[model samples]
Target: MESLHRDDEKRTLRRFLRRQRQALSEHEQRLAAQRLCHQLKALPEIRRAKRISLYLPVNGEIDPTPLIEWLRKRRVEVYLPVLRPFSANVLWFVAYQRDTPMVRNRFNIWEPDMRFSAQRQNRLPAWALDTLIVPLVGYDANANRMGMGGGFYDRSLAFMHRPGPSPNLIGVAHACQQVASLPVEPWDVPLTAVVSDQGYVRRTR
Candidate 1:
């Protein structure tokens, strides 16, 4: 069926892009991260944000953690994506502070401990944040993104589909991850832009 072919194509592309980013040397990764943060600080979305969510990098994903100190200095509330307990492929943004407890999730990605995340006063839904720095496996010039295939982000950001308060989604990746084109899916929640070490690709459509 046509759906099967598209899925196959997406799998192949994801693997290739993942490998490409993982191959970057530590030196390259550090430089890329610095350049990325520099560019992000200039964006009006980031500058005006009162609360923002960011992810910790793994497997060569561009590091957005560098911006935490900068954001904190400005008194902007910073949050990290916590895998919601008992919910499949769902994420809840929990406050990340100097004392926030940390633990590794099943995927080996670090997140705030469940005890802290369970406290309703400490977290916010995706729509409530002013901006979010998302991770990506691959992207196109139009800012179309291919995630790690888990659909966690796509599902968490599904609220964007309706006419309501939609947070600014900024997909972050190394410049090498940009591809010529990508197959967009119905469940795909488009990003406001994709920023890399080189520059940014804003979604024109």
Candidate 2:
């Protein structure tokens, strides 16, 4: 079927790009992360944001911790995505602070501990944030993103499809992850902009 073919194509591209980024040496990865932090911090949207959500890098994903720290110093509230309990393909953004306890989620990624009842008080809805820095396996100049195929972000950000205000969705990735184009799906949420080690790619469309 046509659907099956598109799925296969996406799988192939994801495998290739994941391998490409993972192949980078430690030094290369570190340098790329530093440059990415520099570029991201310079973005006017980022500097103006009072609240933001950022992810901890894993599996060769560009590190955003440096930027997170910078934001914290500026008194900007930083949040991390927590897998919503009992919710299918959805996430809750929980405030991340120095004292916030962390636990590894099902994917083995560290996230703010949601088990503590107090943590719930700090949680914010996805659309409530001013900006969200998302990790991507691959992206294109058009601001289309290729995620890890979990659909978590797509589902949580589905509100963007409706109307009204939406947080600025920014995709972060290594320069090597840039593809000529991506086969975008109807369910996939497009990004407002993408920041890579090379520079920022603002979506004209």
Candidate 3:
């Protein structure tokens, strides 16, 4: 069936891209992270954002931590996504700071400890963020993002499909992750922009 084929294609692409990024040496990854921060800081959306959401890198995902100090200096509140309890594929943004308690989630990723009273108070809805930097398995010139296929982000950001203010979704990855094109699914949310180590791609519909 057509649906099965699409799934197979996505799986293939995801494996290839993940391997590509993982193949980068430590030095290459560090350099890429630095360049990525520079490109992101230059974005008008980032400059104007008071609250932003970012992720910790895993599985060769581009590291965005280099931008944290810069954002902190600018007094921008930084948040990390915490999986919503008992919710199917939903995430809640929790404030992250140097001293914030962290715990390994089911995915074994470190996240703000929501059990802490202070951390709980820092939670915000996704739409409330001005900008969100997401990790990408692969992206194209058209800003179509191929996520890890968990559908967590797509489902969490489904509100974008409705008529309402939505956060500026930006995908970040290594330049090598760029593909000529990617299949877009109905449930997939298009990125506002895609930034790579090289620079920002000129998004075309």
Candidate 4:
């Protein structure tokens, strides 16, 4: 079937792009992170944001932590995505501070400890963020995104499908991850833009 073939193509593309980023040297990773921050800070969405959500980097995902200090200095509230307990591949945005307790989730990715995230005061819904620095396995010039195939973000931001306020979702990845084109799925959430160490691609469609 056509659907089966698209799924296979997506899997192949994901594997290839993942390897491309993971193959970067430590030096290259650091440089890319720095450049990524520079591009982010210059964006008006980032500068004017009072509350934002970002994820910790893993598997060579472009690092957005460097912007934390700058955001903090301006009294901006920074949040990190915590895998929601007992939820179906969904995320909860939890406050990330110098003292926020951290623990590895089932995926071996670090997130705010449940003890801290349990308190409603320490977290916010995805829709409440001013902007979100999202991670992706791949993207295209049109700003279409290919995530880890988990559909976590797509499900979380499904509220956007309706007419109402929604956070600005900004996908970030290594420049090498860009492909000529990508198959957009019905469940896929459109991003405001995709930024990389090299530059950025904003969605016009």
Candidate 4 local lDDT, residue 21: 97
Q: State how far residue 196 of model 3 sits from its true place (Å).
A: 0.5
lDDT of 2 at 95: 95
- Residue runs of model 3 more than 4 Å from their true location after superposition: none
State TM-scores per candidate. Answer: 0.97, 0.98, 0.97, 0.97
Number of colliding residue pairs in each model: 0, 0, 0, 0
Global CA lDDT of candidate 1, please? 0.92
Clashing pairs in model 2? none
How do the residues 1-205 of candidate 2 rate in per-residue lDDT, one tens digit apiece?
9999998999999999999999999999999999999999899889999999999988999888888778988999999999999999799999998899999999999999988987899999899999999999999989889999999999999999988999999999999999999987888887989999989898887
Query: Candidate 4: minimum summed lDDT over ten consecutive residues — where?
Result: 114-123
lDDT string, candidate 1, 170-191, tens digits: 9999999999988888899999
Off by over 4 Å in 2: none
Off by over 4 Å in 4: 117-119
Candidate 1 has its poorest 10 consecutive residues by lDDT at 112-121
Better by lDDT, candidate 4 or 1: 1
Q: Which residue pairs in candidate 1 collide?
A: none
